[model samples]
Target: MRRLVLTSLLLAIVVIGLGAYTRLTHAGLGCPDWPTCYGLIDVPETSIQIAAAEQAFPERHVEPAKAWNEMIHRYFAGSLGLLIAVIAFVSIKLRFSKSSKVRYPIFLPLCILGIVTFQAALGMWTVTLKLMPIVVMGHLLGGFTTLCLLFLLYLRINARRINTQGEKLAESQLKKYSSYALIGITILTAQIALGGWTSSNYAAMSCVELPICQGDWLSDLSFEQSFDLIPPNQESYEFGHLAHNERVTIHVSHRFGAIITGAFLAWLAITIFLKAKTPSIKNTATILLSLLVIQISLGVSNIWFSLPLKVAVAHNLVAAGLMLSLIALTYKLRQNSEESLYE
Candidate 1:
């Protein structure tokens, strides 16, 4: 079960990265259909096939490259979903078995199954609704949530092994710092949502110049339409339908959010490093700090390099890393607290 959870966790990262790549390449609507690309099991490759696909969906021409990108993401996501289902089944089996000595979490796997089902729905809506910002953002959040949950499950299943291997910390120290770690996770999650909203609305490139947006961004900033849950109806939100001002507002907000999130997480990391009684805890803090630095660098590189594809994808991946690192810290702190209670 541990091995399965780890596999699922890694695959979740791949699915997220592929999803980012697909969106960045403007391939969200490449299929123009749910689950299938151009009404076929795979992308229409042959000239005849492409012609048929284009004929059926006259509004959407066949772009083999983009269609393949979308399909590849779907394939991986489908596999991950299946793997989660298996994990849930195995968990249940283990829970009911008379010979089993270890207790496994049945509820978490079942909850993951539910989330994956909803994620599938969001995936369909992302295409059917023509890349609606809310749906896209929801899908992005769903992916992140799924990944975090799997990481949590992994930590739970390995609690004994982890606790035995690590140098113990005083319960008082960890309990005092756990709240800070929790706050750091909360801040990071909100920043990631801001990122998702910015990307979904095609605002990532709205602010070309760093430090701030274009000339007079403050005067032009308007939240009226930028954060609307229900945007006006449109045939397609392919590139983006929002005005330049709205996009600028989103981009600038994300920039500011990054600054705030970075500052808070930096403080938490430093505090943990200084207060940690064990090398394991100290190393976790060091890793968290390093990820923050890398994530910030990637954010800057996105602007400096004009949002290069690789840099943008790396940014998303690093964000996931940051999330997992914080989660690990929180889990370790709580685990130590529990152990201290028994001791």
Candidate 2:
């Protein structure tokens, strides 16, 4: 079960990476259909198949390369889903087995199973909704949520093993750090959501200048349209709507969010390093600081380079990595707290 949980986490990371790749390559609508590529099991190969696909979905031409990118991502996601299901089933089975420890509840798996199912629906809507910004952002959030849940499960399983080995930190100290970690995670989550909104709305390059938007402290901004979820069918959102001001609003807001998130995390890391006695706590804080620097650098690179594909994808990857590092910190602190209570 532990191995399955670990495998699921790795697969979740892969799914996130592939999703980023597909989005960056503008292949979200590669298939123009859900769960299938060109109305076939795979990308259209022969000339006849390509012609048939074009005939069937005239609006969506067959781009074998992009279609393959989308299909491969879907395949990996489906595999991850199946693996999660198996983890859930095996977890439940173990609870009833003769050597059952019953230390872990079946509810966590059940919850993750449900989340994965909903994530699949979000994935379909991302394509079927004509790349609606709202749906695309939702899909991105769903993927990250899945990764976080799987990471938590992995931590819980390991916590049990660690407790059995009688390794524990001071409960008072662990609790203090755990609280700060929780606060940091909450801020980072909001930051990531803002990032999703910015990317889905194609607003990353809205303000090409750095440290400011449109070379001014104030500009024409429309919060309503910027955050608007509904789009008219008449408007071709292929490159996104012509709401130039709204895109700037999103871009500016994300920048402000980055400042707040970065400040909070910096404070948290320093506090941990200066006050914590445990080597694990100190080491995690060091890693957290390193990731924070890298993430900010990537964000800057995205702007300086005008949202280059590789840089944008790397930005997404680093954001996910930062979240996981914080999660690990929280998990470690919680583990110490649990063991402290047992002792």
Candidate 3:
């Protein structure tokens, strides 16, 4: 089980990295279709084959590198699916075999089983739907959420510094913090979706300042143009044309959200530092502050440098890390408080 958990985490890490790679290579629409590249399961190999496929879609040309990048992402995702399947199988095997992990109260595997299925479907839709900004963002969040949940479970099962119950102070504030964390997760996920949308549409460079978009504290952009689901030009989106106005909209929203999120975290961290006794809480707060600063710095760098691939990817990666860190902190703070009180 330990091995399985470790492998799953690694697989997820690789997939996340691959996803970024696909974005950097501009291969989100490389395959130009889902479950197949140019309508074939495996990517086309030779120019003749590529031409034959391109001939089929005379209007669309499949760049070899772009298709490969997209296909590689799918392969990694497929690999992650295999790990999840194994986890589900072992969970059932452990369930019926009278394992020691299954004591008076059994841990549930059904939730994970359900989530894996949903994630697979969502993954398919991310491509089939031609990387719809909203769906892609949802899928990205779902991926991290899966990883964090698995990590928490692994910590509990391995007894790696995770307590099943709370301390006195942990108990008194459990419910309050739980709600706060949930809210944070919700907001953070939406912000990430906006971030992904901005990147997918090539809009990260649309605005170039922090605490403002286009020189305003509040991003002033045409949401109606930018957020339109369909391309404003009435062209096929897979041809790689997205709503530029929509892209601009996403850029502005994400930038402002980061400012708001960073401000919120600064306040949240100070509050936790003052009100919570756990050193872990203090540490989480500190780490979050650092991440907030790093994220903003990267965001600015992305623009000043004209959306350099490396910095853009780093900015995306940092957002993911921040989201997970907040989730972990929320879980620890709220649950620990509850146990402290209950005990």
Best prediction by TM-score: 1
Q: What is the lDDT of residue 50 in candidate 3?
A: 88
lDDT of 2 at 214: 62
Q: Which stretches of candidate 1 lie over 4 Å from their true place?
A: 337-343
Provide the lowest-lDDT 10-residue window in model 3. Answer: 334-343
lDDT of 3 by residue, 218-330 (tens): 44556665665544442334423544454556777777787777777777766766777666666776787788789889878887877787887777678777876787677
Q: Global CA lDDT of candidate 2, please?
A: 0.84
Indicate whether candidate 1 or candidate 3 has the larger TM-score: 1
lDDT (Cα atoms) of all candidates against the true structure: 0.91, 0.84, 0.68
Which candidate gets the maximum lDDT versus the true structure? Answer: 1
TM-score of each: 0.97, 0.94, 0.81
So what's the TM-score on candidate 1? 0.97
Error of 3 at 320 (Å): 1.8
TM-score of structure candidate 2: 0.94
lDDT, model 3 = 0.68
